[model samples]
Target: MKPRFPIPLLVPLLLSVALAADDDFSFDFITHGPMLGEVTDSTVKVWARSQRPGEYAVRYGTDPASLDQVSAPLKTTIEHDNTGWVTLTGLKPETTYHYQVYHDTLPTGPAGGFRTLPNAEEHREPEHNPRGLFNFSFQFGSCANQNPNHGIGPSLPTHATMRRTLPGKALFSIMNGDFIYEEHRTLPVTNWLSQVGLTPGESPEIVKLAPSVVGLWENYKTYLSRGVNLAAWQRNMPTVFTFDDHELVNDIRGAGTTGFRERRAVFRDIGIRAWEDYAGWACPRATSQGIHFGTAKLEEGSDILTDKDADFSKIDLAQAANLHVHWGTDSAGVDDIRLDAESPANPNAGVYDVLEVLDAHRLRVTPAAVADSTGSYSIGRRSHGKFTVSNCDFFLLDCKTHRQMHDPKEPGKKGLTLLGDRQKAWLLEEMEKSGADFFFVVSSVNFMIPHNGAGGHEFAEGKDEAWTSMLDERERLIDAFDALRKPVFILTADLHNSFAIKITDRVWEFASGPLNSVNHVPKNDEGDRPATGLFRSGPRTCDIRWSSYILPDLERLQRLYPYYCVAQINNVFNMPKELGGTRWVAYPNPQVIFQYFDGRTGAFQYAEAIGTERKP
Candidate 1:
């Protein structure tokens, strides 16, 4: 072959072989640092995935060279169809520990490193600061689409700089939904290929882009490929994740029989599956065959006041539904099913069913059912225990599942879609049983207020009635949690901008926007409101005091975009015995810069914290 091979062919062949070999022996590592959650002290979790599966090992120590000191090794198994993950335990709270990972079989692969969180117990007191006062810092933002044109890929330089400057600063990061924009395009082939980047005639990985099922798998693979660096970071750190619209399909509901719903379910299933494959721990254990939905106790009944106290009963059903019917439309006085009042008699009483039906008719329902159906829903569905890493107890609500399709002209017909009897009871139970300091609730959309800015109305046009219904639920939750006097924080993302608001009873709403996205910022300067401190530029930190209230001005910055925010509750150890509490300080202003290609000449524009002026 050496004597007879053509020079051009031989040269190309050699290069191909070299590239393949390099890929085979290479391992990319990402890190997410230690994170603390409700009822739980400080703990760190990390993630990583290999191009090829083999025995993998993670090692750690306080010193880079002495990883042998506290290093623990974990052997990962391929679950949920090839996603890889590892969770470390029994470490000191709040104390930082350096760590690294290596392949047992391949000595030539890359070795990665990261640091763990401080022991929480050691720093229980606000002034019990570390010898030098290590700033507790981390950044979070959502709405990152996989599209290179609008995602983190284009802003690589800014993020890289931030990472370099804040080495070991962030304990963890949360990918609060919309991680991938797979459904924007219409063509299944094109959408699937866009995710992982392979043509139809290419390898099996490429061919696996058809049928919603295969498309999901391909989408996951594609997401991992594009987020190689992110994966590397996650591998070294611990990450908490939740999904948004784009993760499955945009603005999807579960009520209808439309292709969107079916595909959405597939998207959700596969999306979660992909998450498990390439990221951190996802509940609802994965089986060799496929993934399963986790369960929660759901009840059905009337009398909102007594529902929580009602005895439990089980009814077999698929997902969360409305508890009652408040209104119905009559096409000819036949008790139009669409406008029926919220009732336990209806089979589709849960929120999920209502949403499904609404999507089917392109209309919303109102006066939704309220019932108790805990045993029915909990059967087989996945559960995230009582708490998540952010130190808050969470209730993942299926809010829009039950709603009436309002008359396009009668916006007044829309009324509150309260939590059905079952979910309400369950929520109250969780709140009463919660031993954590904070209550964190997750809804797919905003629950408190509506967007009053320009273009905001368009975003919420047909959804106003639904929002009104939500107001009651929001108030109810607040009142319940407020009565407990426990500090609660709401974490939600959907809006493409990062914002925070203080609710009554010391409750705070922290809303993060889509990462790497450019939605129309409400033309109104409402975001500039003085009380709203937007972190535009520079590093900022917040310190929690013992009074159960966050002290303002730890690090204040003005308008900034393309950034992440972290809310930390500190000073519990110094809490006074009478008030029974700790305080939080919103601190350290940090700004993020974004770069995008100008349509005119394909030049990149640099956008950063332009000023300290607050949004009105």
Candidate 2:
């Protein structure tokens, strides 16, 4: 019966368009989004914002009132504040237009839709790079703390139970990190900034923002003028994101290359400019001070973990002594590098001024070759890339940006990385150029053993940010997935206890958490608290299997619709295991239990597949 998402008529249509007051002059709405970013094969990119400004455009085609196609204007001001980001270009692939969003000729909101990406000859058929069928399904989740007390505002009853279970054209959703909780919107949000007029105790202006300014775009414009569940789940699909570490804080750290560049540009330029001004996210070549300006050399000397591919030079610091190199670049398209240090007096000290959050923005140093002298540092940009959908191919790994703070003079470790040597030689050279029989690795962090320094956020050796605080890049990403014996499967969600763990026995490590934040359950160091599969204290919305990849008819992936659960703890013998792998604890008292439901209704809460090695 999953139907309840009127949210009292979507909270007065998103509060009359974020408290509109154009009075009647038209445009005073859609101050947040129309969202739907990065789609190709003829291009698509709409994402709105214009409660005030003027001229903007994105009319769109495929006819809707003979919608004579458009595209030009885009004037929304505030220097990127009145946000617009238009890009309609040609258009065709899997096609499905019918859009809206104007301010000049009038027509403010309503009338939205999008669909692109499906033209490599409609994702190839007729045996083109053939292999089993699996069409598509990405539907990911992550921490969202819109603070409905502590969380769950845009988690929207599981975004209306994933929009009534992936209905009509649904193959795109990957918000792999804290959507908001924007470091408490950087303090001082006094009396709701006086109900939008300011003065109750005033201090707003995002508390004098700037450290690069990403106050969650003012905390998602006050969580979408007070919640409409992430503008009704990003105006009906087409979402792609990444930003662990509470968007900015609560575990924030991504420096190296001698870090401290103005304190790593304060949170890497206001947390990637508040996630590219609230998810318009397009920073690979990002500049205008947001940062991602590449440059890292030293390969012949080898060692940035060796995802080889270097060019930019100039650092001969005493003829590149101590050797041990490897540093790469190619961000706008992805193939980053870093890790393995030494031979640096200032071998470009190895660029720490990058952001968005690791996959190695920049952090270098790696000498070792003569009794290893200090030689260790792994900062980030090792994220490599890949993202097909319907036929399957999701490889985006770079967990824990760039790290520092160590002490391993040979306790089974030296200078390894979670993925930074040009993302482990671009993930074993893109898994020998995968052909996709079904693969996965969209990690942002999480191999298991939860306790990211728990309420203390450690590193000095307390580690725990996922992947055992860097067990030399987690055993070199588990020997590069046990030498890519194929059979790939490892989707992650920052440990809110989304479940399915066990790191070996063939690699399994599924999870989902904070998908919308504030569920904390992590306490250890003697405090103890982690094991709690299928969680949901408040930021409701759960799953690690989520219909084993959000259905789309794989024989209806064991149906479970109408389910809108809210932290339904079934305690499969106190589920959420991995007690010895490191720290994924949680079954402390689970005595006798085994619960699993296929179809849900009584408030819906059943994604019981706990991190997967299977045994629900």
Candidate 3:
């Protein structure tokens, strides 16, 4: 200033300062690894995503060094809102290939790599696929919360470690649910941002983002950034993900009209957006548009509201006043007033319809909603639409959507329902028609019986009785499997513990412990008897094996009677504090091999000529 520098020199100095400022701007570009899908002899589906939006490209080859040899261009698309995902196809089976994804423009940012699954048909020989051989080795877990103080944040590092340790071997990983803890706003996002050293004012772009979605996106980003271990895993492996309660508001009933419906709707939109962004691509257009209810049957004499009839714009002042008086007010007073004033003879037959015009308008505006009250059930043709993945039929059941009356006297809670009659029929039909070898039923909550508490282990208390009411349906579904006798394995992760249960005519169940949480095995002296009497009699009726790995601290395993193994990883010896974590000990892996068992004696004394392969 004193020297009065030339205008050209001043311009250069300003430009350099601006460049430096831009360079100092801190942002995160977390990547979710390559997930395998649509596997076949010739090709398989490989997908990946990053936090930031940009052109995504994938380069692949058998050799890690020469990934350029089999490089393929990929198109990144938006799913929920901000998460960027890409899928690569036409990969050969049983081949090892390395892949790297780079932003089209921000080339300087991080680029990760992953491998694909083998061709299912290629493993013809026993040697090639040994005993207990699985075509794929996948690691799936759920119930991860964002804990910044722990450094792992919301996502589990052990799963990532397992993926990295396995390297080119892991086919895929499934994040069953609770991918983020956004809905529970007890932990403020601002606090999280502060922990991450992010100033709120610096990133004005995030201000426009929805709180739930922002929380989820931030948690995901934090995992990617803080997950130095997970980054290594993602660079080598891909993950397939699904949402549970935490993804949206916890325990949301999609079709129900509870007070939280509006909040749930918002949560669903934001959750799906965050899911599409952080996870791989999900085509939820059908779900998003509420098209799944097209085939839903209505209960007789029920008021079925439709988008057109219940449209906010359609309600005139009189119609709105009538609705407010009838539905908005208490039901008790209306029944008495209508009985005494309108119909003196029949008190029970209270004001069923406020106005014939409303009913007629409902019929014209929303025929589906009108038909819903008719008691005649409808079953829409089972179509996967966009949510289906090849070789796997995902029955993402709507267990939490409907509210059913519950009885308190039942062993478990009486309110839970596995499926309404219509959904049950559709599910059976789908199962019967399914061509895939494995049917992966993704339920947010546990489908199997709970061991800890009776009365269905209240996840949402009074509002969640519908989930507990379906014991009969659960048994019926199990019976269907017993009748069809097809190979079926159910994956659920709401219990915060990992378990593998073998459900047959004879109850042969095996449960795994939680990867996180406190490890507490029921001591024999504690007298926590087995629920199905499978523990006392022997391993015949059920072979239940439970294990828990509480990182950097403990690991324990317990089998019913003949064998129980427990191992704890403590820093007692000359081991590093970080790697001193313990893992549960067990002789046989808990995977069911479809063997015969003695229900009466609880014994597996006979051997069958069945081809059982281990899951690698």
- Candidate with top TM-score is 3
What's model 2's TM-score? 0.30
Any runs in candidate 3 off by more than 4 Å, and if so which? 1-52, 69-81, 104-113, 120-134, 146-157, 182-211, 251-269, 280-426, 435-440, 451-469, 500-502, 506-513, 519-616
The global C-alpha lDDT for each of the candidates, from Candidate 1 onward, is 0.40, 0.46, 0.39
Cα deviation at 120, candidate 1, in Å, is 5.2
Per-residue alpha-carbon lDDT of candidate 2 for residues 1-616, written as tens digits (9 for 90 to 100): 7646677887888778765654545445566767777666576667777755557787878777766788877666554456667677888776777777766566676666656655444322333222212223345667666555454444456565566555343546667766666433433334334323345444323233331242445666766656675676676577767666566444543333333321221243344445666673521221122222222343434333221222213222221111112121111101111212213332333333321211332223443122222211222222234666443456765343444433323323567454445545665676667754335676766654434444344444454556555555556665577565544556676655455544444455565554444344443421132344343211222222332122223222122221112112221221123554311222222121112222122233434322212333
> Residues 191-291, candidate 3, lDDT per residue (tens digit)?
64564445666433322333333456555665566556555655555555556655655544332222211223223333444555565343222222221
Candidate 3 TM-score, true structure as reference: 0.58
**Cα error, candidate 3, residue 481 (Å):** 2.0
Which regions in candidate 1 have their CA more than 4 angstroms from the true location?
1-43, 69-81, 105-114, 120-138, 146-153, 156-158, 161-170, 183-211, 220-224, 227-229, 255-267, 279-425, 442-444, 451-469, 523-560, 572-616
Candidate 1 per-residue lDDT, tens place, 370-415, comes to 4433211111122122343333455554332332332323323324
Please give the clash total of every predicted structure, in order.
123, 46, 34
Instruction: Give the total clashing residue pairs for model 2.
Output: 46
